[model samples]
Target: MTVLDDSTAPGLVGPPHSHGPRRDPAPLLPDPEPVRILGTPAAKTFDAELQRDLYRRLVLGRRFNQQATTLTRQGRLAVYPASTGQEACQITAAMVLREVDWLFPSYRDTLAVVARGVRPLDALTLMRGHAHSGYDPYEHRIAPLSTPLATQAPHAVGLAHAARLRAATDPAAAEDLVALALVGDGGTSEGDFHEALNFAGVLGAPVVFLVQNNGYAISVPLASQSAAPSLAHKAVGYGIAGRLVDGNDALAMHSVLSAAVEHARSGRGPVLVEAVTYRLDAHTNADDATRYRSAAEVDAWRARDPLTLLEGHLRAAGLLDDAGVAAAAKAAEVLAGEIRAQFDNPPDPDPDSLFTHVYARPTSQLREQAAELAARLDADADAALAAATDAEDEAR
Candidate 1:
């Protein structure tokens, strides 16, 4: 039987239902204001121990940014995107996840990688132009710092879905491992970002997307990127919960991100959290932020620096003293020294090592190329040794 429209059957015609019923969009919308825990009543109830820990991490994260930027100027790092003002987001993103969980970070998120237990020097390997990923992803459960925008989102989704499938089949050793994918505000424009969120929403996979909306996507401001009210609102279209939080407030970031991570781990659909923050530094050491942004604007953000904000809160509460500050500084200095030492005397990367572990069975072309390179290197070494021997004979 064929259903007829009003032309064929008057009873078939529906009233005011051209596109069927519209879903309630209000439920999907983010809070009217970004969530704030600092300088609010909520701060009073926040755990003091957690606040102190966050303070230490924030201090260290800032130092990491500074050191990395300096390394770029000193010709150690190839490039550095200093997340100076966005330390709160980086710190909270790392601290919220468990060891069993995975973190997919962007190129600028070296601090997050370090916070997740990757050595500071190893985390900088990609930026140092030394390796694809300095440390193995499996070793730390963190993906390589993604240089391509939004690519890691899908990777996180796939990993989260895979983990859920394993947990479904194996109950004894099963654990709730959440995949936290971090992307910048600019990354949301990429197709991969939408695809990842769509997959997570459909599968109810254990994944959380923390988008740090650091004002500008390099030189292009967010206003020029999209007309969406906020980046968080984009999640509503994918049938997932959206959140907005003050990214600069460590406590707020921790609270919001922790909830999202827990929600994902509990097998709830994925959540999109847009942290409202600003990039204090240029896109990278090479890019001049002054061209796109104003000094006054940068000054305004610097006033609300993550470290300063947290430090003030801690001091007011008597949780941090002068001694505590000194201790944190000492720890940061030690880390800076380690990073400098590693860079100053970095181990020479074997060219042959690049050909190794690329595949289970090497391709014919790869084998040929590796052999060619090895032969060339051997010939060069032999030539150098012969020259040294001739020099010794001349000396005698």
Candidate 2:
């Protein structure tokens, strides 16, 4: 029996075939070693102003993550998936995008959301158990901090594809539009991840997928989650560019993400970036990380902390002096205070607000449910008033 090859049977090989030369996947593959900027000669050429800005944001992001975690302990926040050690990736992801571009962030990407100009308290509303989404997504061009894993990937692709279609008719907006979707390592296992990437590749959507491979997916380690060479390598199968960067290295992440964003904006299609970072904190305030990871492992990542890595580079370069360090610390303190004050007396969302955005035109069932809820609330108010009046009469 003779076996058929792709040369004779193009149909058997699927969509990778075209009339011209077959695209080489080798050039598109990520580096064997994760790209590094700090502790290297490349650090010298990096823009001093951008370096300093990244440093400030990383400092603020670390403080923000800590503050959110503390709120969870204080019962102020319902839950928080703190991106403590992954601040580099968070800050860089937000910094790379243009104002017109859209950002689809994961639940753990609160830092990214705030970095993109979303108010600190506003970003926390969904996690605070108050409303569906805290701020208007259209106004800020940020999709809701997605609670469901990998779901935002498809949404980002759809938006990017739509924008590309719009740009085809209007050349003025062509270069200004792109979309970014962030996902965690654990989310990569979801079927949505595959679907989104497949569609993005086929449609040539102007989107970037940033996968922060922060060692674990809650309790599951990366080893158990994937047997692939690296998360970035998965992009090769989709026929797009892939990148790997030191996620803890702020400058490296900023450089890589900036390139990817520009490529997407220029209509080059999607790029998948896998940032190798570590999550120092537990899954959340409620998790016991000690049960899953050893203290030695956590200490190792802490030693190579994103803040200290950038701070060390800045200090050695003389771009950041004693006064500069003090100023950054003071700014972070101010942010922490602001977060505390806002969350201390968080605004109570109206009970009826839930039904307001349920649909463009609410269905009959939703209308009935809303009426029932309103009636129940009125009855409770009447009962409380009657009880208070009876007590007053008895006292008289």
Candidate 3:
């Protein structure tokens, strides 16, 4: 009997049909070594003023993380996923976007949200157990802090695609608008991640997915989480560009993310950037990091802290002096103080807000539920009033 070879089969041969334009994967592949700027010759060429600003933000971000962790301990916050060692990725992600652009951040990205002009208190509202997102997403062009893994990826793509479509008819609508979604390494395993990238590549949506691969997905090491060469390599599978950078290198992260944002804005389709940083704190206040990671591992990463790395570069370059360091520290302290004061007496959210934005036109069932809630609230108020009146009558 003769066996048929699969390579000679009718449908197994060459690229005979065209589905769409074929892209060169070589251009999309990330560099073998993660990009670095701090402590390198490239650091000399970066803008001094911008570097100074970035350093200030890093300082503020560090303080913000510390205060948030403390708040969790004090029971002021329900939970906080501190970005202690990933300040560079967090702050750079926010700074790269234009005011018109949108940001979709994960639950661990309160630093990015705060860096994007959101009040610290508002950024922590969800962690404070608020019913509604503390800040108005429409006003800030930012989605709520997504607690669900990879869910914001699709939302970012949708917004970017819609903006691109609008720009086709009215150029003014675009205004170089793009969407940047920040996700953790763990989120990459989700189906939504694959779907978002697939749609983004096919539709040529103007969006950037920044994966902060901080070594672990809450305790599961990257080795166990993914077998990909690197998280950035995953982008090439979707026919989009990929980039890798030292997540702890503030200058490099800013540079890489800035270029990625512009690339998306110019309609080059989506880009995926994997920032190789480390998470210094536990997943949250409740998580015992010691249970999973060794102390030496944490110490190793602490030495390469984003703040210390950037500060050393700045000081060595004569861009930052003792006075500058002191000033940055002072500013950071002020921010920490503000966070403490606000969280010490956080205002209670309106209970009715739960039903406010649930739907554009409330369904009958929703209306019925809202009415029932209101009735209960009214009854409680009436009972309190009657009890107070009775107490006063007894005193008389």
Which prediction has more favorable lDDT, 2 or 3?
3
Steric overlap count per candidate: 0, 0, 0
Error at 181, model 2, angstroms: 0.8
Positional deviation of 102 in candidate 3, in angstroms? 0.8
Query: Candidate 1 lDDT (Cα, whole model)?
Result: 0.91
Worst 10 residues of 3 by lDDT: 1-10
Of the two candidates 2 and 3, the one with more favorable TM-score, higher being better, is: 2
Give the alpha carbon lDDT tens digit for every residue of 53-86 in model 1: 9998888898889999999999989998889999
Estimate, for each residue in 123-152, the C-alpha lDDT of model 3 and write its tens digit.
899898875378899989999999889999
* Native-referenced Cα lDDT, model 3: 0.92
At residue 43, what lDDT does model 2 achieve? 97
TM-score of each: 0.93, 0.93, 0.92
Model 2 Cα lDDT, one tens digit per residue, 212-321: 99999889999999998999999988888899999999999999999999988887889999999999999988889998899999999999999999999999999999
Which residue segments of model 2 deviate by more than 4 Å?
1-21, 172-175, 392-396
Mark the regions of model 1 whose C-alpha exceeds 4 Å error after superposition. 1-23, 388-396
Q: Which ten residues in a row have the lowest lDDT in candidate 2?
A: 1-10
Best by lDDT: 3
**Runs of candidate 3 exceeding 4 Å displacement:** 1-22, 385-396
- lDDT of each prediction vs. the true structure? 0.91, 0.92, 0.92
